[model samples]
Structures are given as structure tokens and as C-alpha cells.
Target: MYAVLSVTDKTGIVEFGAGLRKLGASLVATSGTAGLLRDAGMDAAVIGDLSGVPEMMGGRVRAFHPSVFGGLLYRRGNASDEAEAHQHGIPRIDVLACNFKDLVADDGIAGALDSIDIGGPAMLRAAAKNFPSVLPVVDPADYGEVLRALGAAGGEVAAVDPAFRRSLAAKAFGRTCAYDRSIQRILDTTGDRE
Candidate 1:
């Protein structure tokens, strides 16, 4: 299975990627994530290699390519979608493991709020939108469940189960809601309004 591991939170990610690799899955990641995986001795291919585009603007322009989106959004069983993906050289993305940047307030500035990722959110939303074809995982806590499912399925947990897909959709929506709330709170505090 092709597993994409792009996370702002580096918690347990190296171990998770290593475990996934050990379970016979290909690991794909962005710059920092790829570095972490390599540092942990896990074989991870950089997203740029797949997308053929280097990270630009302080790692802002990574994973925004058609290749990445096609992989995450295309339905495997649909002949048209699969054909289109093949024509565009897009590999199927089975699992998307991601976590939003943790916003932390410090010295009258919110570090985590500032670190809100644009590309990460877009990718997560795309994966969640195509949940029938893609398995989107936002919480590291769900790693064990995923691993268990993969093991049970003989190292092929690419298909998103109905129940798990619903859970992932809920989590994705909650994450967006939380991000909006943070922005609202920041605006409320900074703006001059009653």
C-alpha cells in the first residue's frame, strides 16, 4: 500500500513510518517528514520525487500538485478515474496519515495558530473527500487500529471501511472547525470590537 505521512506534529511519526515500512508499505512524505523518517532509518521517498517539484516558499508549495491530488482523490475501482490517473502517472494513495500543526500561544503570540498549514489542510480535505477510495487518518492514536487492520488484511489495508471512513470524515470536519475557531478567537482578541 502507498502510505503518505505528512504531519506537522512529529509525535510518534518516525516509529509509525518505520512500522508501516516494516509491514511492507511504501512511505511518502514531505521535507521535514522525510528527514525524520530517514533519521529513523526508515526508507521514505520525498513528495518532491513523486510530484517532481521542489518545496518552495519555506515548504509551502509541497504536495499541491496534480500527481498528489490525483492519487488521493481518484477512485480505484472506477475505470474512468483509474484510467485518468494512469494517464497522468499518479500512483494510488492508500493511506494518508496527517496531523494539523498544534497551535500554542506564547508571549502574546500564538505559535501553533501561526503554524496553521495550508497545503496540509488541502491534502487532508482532499483525502477525506475521497474517503471511499482513500483512508484518511488524522490522529496518531488511530495508528494501532490501522496497523491491526493492515496485518489482518495481510498487509493491504488500502480500502477504507465504511465505519472507519465515517470516523475519518468526522475527524476531518472537526479539525477544520477547530481551525476556524482558533482564527475567530484570534480575530476577536486582535480586532477593536465590543
Candidate 2:
């Protein structure tokens, strides 16, 4: 099993990652996130390492690769998707724990614009879109619930309740939508609405 985790909010992440590790899931994360996990004595693969693409553009272009999205978007039971995934060596991403930067941060206009997360929302949406196979976790508060569900299913993602996954997916979409709205508001106030 694989879990991709990237977040601007670091609350409860180490514990959540630990739970996932205990459940036999391999952890993949952005460089900063991976460093924190490693400091916590947990093994985590850097996103660049998994995607075969180094973090570039001051880390803005880290997780926007096909390798990462392919893992999250591919249909589980579709033979063509499976074959293409195998051909590309993209592992199945069974879980995604992601949260974006808060636009409310006391950063200036340039900083606030930078805080408009791209990769986080993209990955979250792709995982949520494939909720039948992927578990999308948007909030840290729900980490324990997800861990419990995975534990109850014996760490078998396929055995997890579809309703639960669907609910998480819905939450993921809601989060992204709110994030975009915040960005739009910021841009509007700055007189640079696009």
C-alpha cells in the first residue's frame, strides 16, 4: 500500500504517518514533509524520488507529474489502466493526506499568491475522483478516523467501506473549493483578479 502526504499544515502529521507506517503503508511526501517524517524516525520517500523529477521552481512544481497523478487516477479494475500503470512503473496510491496553505496567513500579496497551492489541490482532486480505490484525507482532525478504518479493514484498502471513502472524497473537494474561493478573494482585494 502507498500513501502520498503533502501539506502546509503540519498538525498531527507525524502521528498519522506513524499509524500508516504501522499499517504497512509506504510513505511518499514532498521534501520538507519527508524530512519531518524522517526526523520522527519514519521512512518516507521524497516525491521527487518517486516521480523521477527533482523539485524545481522554488518547489512549486514538485507533485505536478504524471507519475504521481497516474497512480491516483487510474481505474482499479480496468485492464488497460493497469497495464499502462505497470508499463510506467507507477505504484497504486491507496491513500492521500493533503492540506493546502491558509490564505489567512500574515504574508504580503506576493507571499499570499505563492501560498495559493497548486500541487496539493491537483493531487487531492485526482485521488478524490478515484475514491472507489483511493482514500482522500483533507483534514488532520480526521486522521484518527482514517487510521481506525484502515485498522478495522486489516490495512486492506479494498476492504474499506466505499461510503467512508466517498465521504472523504466529498470533503476533499469541499476543501479545494474553499481554498480557491479564498484565493479569488485575495486576488480581488489586491485588484488583480484574474
Candidate 3:
């Protein structure tokens, strides 16, 4: 399994990645997460390197490339999709462990704008959309449940139930929606939904 880990909340990430490695999974990580994984002695493929795109705009453009999205969006088990994935060199993304940047920060103006996340939510939504095939974990707390399920299946995503995957997808979508709403609220001066 190929897992992607990009998170703002770093709690339990190293151990979670280690557990994934134990289950015969490799990690694809963003710059910060890759540094942490390397510190823990785990091998990880950097997102920029995998995408063949240089990190630009002071590291703002990360994981938005086709190499990343194709892995998350492609359908598995479909002969055409599988053949296309192979032709495009998109590795199968089995898991997406992610969290967004904090929406509220006390450091001032720079922090406020930087809090809005673009890439993280996109990855989450895509992975969630392709559930059962891809487990999108937004909260670190659910990592244990996912690890247990994967361990029980000996690391095969197909062994996990469709309903559970659907539930997780719902959670991923809800989280992104809430995050966007918060951003809207901060941007809104009138305080009305419209």
C-alpha cells in the first residue's frame, strides 16, 4: 500500500507511519512530514520528488500535481482505469493521513492568511471520494482503528468494509466543509451566510 501523510497536527504521526510500514506499506510525505519520518528512520517518498514538480511560491504548491491526484482519483480493479494508471505512472494511493493548517493563529496578519489550506483539503476530498480503495484519515485519533483494520486484513484495503469507508468519506467531506465555512466566516464582514 502507498500512503500519503501531510498534516499540521503531528501527534502520533511517526508511530502511525511506523505501524503502516510494519503492515508492508510505504509513505509519501510532504516536506515537513518527510523530515519527521526520516528522523524516525522510516523511508518516505517526497511529494515534490514524486510529482516531478519543484516546490514553488515558498512551498505553497505541494501535492497538487497529476502524479498525486491521479493516484487518489483513479479507480482500482477496473481494467481500463488500472491500465491508464499504469500508463500514467500513478502509484496506487491506499491511504491519506492529513490535517489542515490551523485556521486561527496568534502571530498576526501573516498567520491569518496562511491558515487557509488549499492542498491538504484537496487531497482529503479526493481520497475520500475513492474510499475502500483509499482510506482518508483526517484526524489522528482514527489512526489506531485504521491500523487495526489493516493489520487484521494483513494490509489489504479490499478487506475493509464499504460502509466503514463511506462513513470515513463523509467525515472527510464534513471536515473540509467546516474548514471552508470557518474561512468564509473570517472573510465575511456582514456575518451573514450570503
Candidate 4:
């Protein structure tokens, strides 16, 4: 199974990606995430290779391709989805580990907020939308649970656990909602309120 790891948090990501890799899952990550994995001597491919798009605007435009979305959005049981994925060379992304930038009051929060990532949220939402086929993880705390599930089910648990899937979808929506709230707060404080 393929796992997409595009997190701004950068907490426990190296260990999480390594664990996923150890379980025979392929890792697709963005710039900083790829760097973190590589720095920890883990094999991680850049998301651009998977999506065919360079991360532009200081890495804000990553993972915004049809390749990315198709992999995350395609239904596993649909023959047409499988055919289209095969035709476009898009692999199914079974797991997505993503966390948005924390909108906290810090020295780098301003610049980081500027690169808070629209595409990442969209990808998370799409993966969450297709949660029955994909497992979306938003919190670092759930890494071990996912690892345990993957271990127990031989990497095929995405199809068997409706409660787990729903929990992931709920987290995905919460992350997006928090992200939007952060942006709104920033706008309000910066006099960009509308």
C-alpha cells in the first residue's frame, strides 16, 4: 500500500514514515517531509515525482495534481476507477498522514502561516472523503494505532474497520476546520477581516 506523508508539524514524522516503510508501505512526501525522512536515512520519494508538479510559491503548491487526487479519491471497487488509475499510472494511496501548520503565536508563525498549504488541505479532504478506501491520519498520536492495525491486518485494515475509518474522517474535517479558523484569526488580527 502507498502512504502519503505531507505534514507541516514535523513531529515524529521520521519515526512514523520509517515504521510505515518497515511495514512495506511506499512513502510519498513533500519537500521538508522528504528531507526529514532522508535525513533520518529513510527512503522517501518526493511528491513532485508522484504528482508531476514542482512545489511553487515557497512550497505552497505541492500535491495539487490530478495524479495526487486520483490516487486519493478513486474508489477501490469501481472498475472505472481502476482503469483510469492504470491508464494514468496513478497508484492507490491507502494511507495519508497529514497535519496542518500550527497557528500558534511564535516567531516563525507569520511566514509559516503564509505557507500553510491549500493543496495539502484539499488532498486531506479528498482522502477523507474516500476514507473507506484510504486511512487518513491527522494526529501524531494515532501513528502507533495505525501501525498496530497495519501489523495485525497485514496492511489490509482499511477495508475492515468502519469505526477507524470514521474516526479518521472526523479528524480530517477537524483539521481543516482548525486550519480555517486559524486563517480567520490571523486575518482578523491583521486587519484583513472581511
Per-candidate Cα lDDT values, in order, are 0.78, 0.90, 0.86, 0.83
Clashing pairs in 1: 103-112, 104-112
Better of 1 and 4 by lDDT: 4
- Winning candidate number (lDDT): 2
lDDT of 3 by residue, 7-109 (tens): 8999999999999999988798999999999999999989987899978888778878988999998988989989999998998889999997546434344
Residue-pair clashes per candidate: 2, 0, 0, 0
Worst 10 residues of 3 by lDDT: 185-194
Compose the digit string of candidate 2's lDDT tens values, residues 121-187.
9999999999988899999999999999999999877789888988999999999999888887776
* Cα distance off (Å), candidate 2, residue 66: 1.7
What is the alpha-carbon RMSD of candidate 1 to the true structure? 2.9
Candidate 2: segments with Cα more than 4 A from true spot: 105-109, 192-194
Residue lDDT tens for model 4, 20-83: 8988998999878988899899888888888778878777677878888999999997999999
Residue pairs with colliding backbones in model 2 are: none
lDDT of 1 by residue, 1-194 (tens): 68899887888888778778877878999878988899888889999988999888777688899988989998878999989988989988878888775343442335433466777778888888887767778888888787776667666544435787778867976786686677566555643332
All candidates: TM-score: 0.87, 0.94, 0.91, 0.89
- Which candidate would rank higher by lDDT, 2 or 4? 2
Better of 1 and 2 by lDDT: 2
Error of 4 at 118 (Å): 0.5
Model 4 misplaced regions, further than 4 Å: 104-113, 192-194
- lDDT value, candidate 4, whole model: 0.83
Off by over 4 Å in 3: 105-111, 190-194
